[model samples]
Target: MQAKAYLQHPILGQRLRECTQIILNVDGRSAEEIFGYPDNLKFRSCLTLFMTATTDNKVFKDALLKYFDGKPDTVTFDILAHH
Candidate 1:
């Protein structure tokens, strides 16, 4: 409901998208501990949700693409490497 309401205002939605940031913190925990075991839905759901969001959400995709003023790859690499 809130997401739908936000979508109603394109400018506001875009601004929100621009302000979003994601930290893929793999270093903080083991991969299995983070996503859960494959026998359960937690692992699949988390992966699927992320895949769908990144692939289907145009605004989110663009924001990620332009992360840190179009330095997503470099910045993300640095972060993951450091952390």
Candidate 2:
């Protein structure tokens, strides 16, 4: 299922909303501002895990590089920090 759909699943939706609220309370920014949106955060986190799990895969590396538009390291670091 797509990240948005998965996030909308009742249990997962509640968990994500709770987490997002906590994050906003501490950071004072909406999840959209910090992570694009809940779905974007889910997608980025999944992609990060995929990249890490397949570190030797050239295709994953290439895709991640393209995802970050040539700033993969910096963007990945920021994403990691945010999560």
| Candidate 1 clash pair list | none
* Total clashes in model 1, counting residue pairs 3 or more apart in sequence or in different chains: 0
- RMSD of every candidate to native, in Å, equals 13.0, 12.0
Q: Mind giving the per-residue lDDT tens digits that candidate 1 earns over 1-73?
A: 3444564577965564443323232335433454456522333332333323333455444433332232234
**Model 2 Cα lDDT, one tens digit per residue, 1-83:** 24456455789655754553445354444334656756555544554544454333344344334444423444655755676
In model 1, which runs have C-alpha deviations exceeding 4 angstroms? 21-83
RMSD score of candidate 2 (Å): 12.0
Error of 1 at 71 (Å): 22
Best candidate per TM-score, number? 2
Model 1 TM-score, all chains together: 0.26
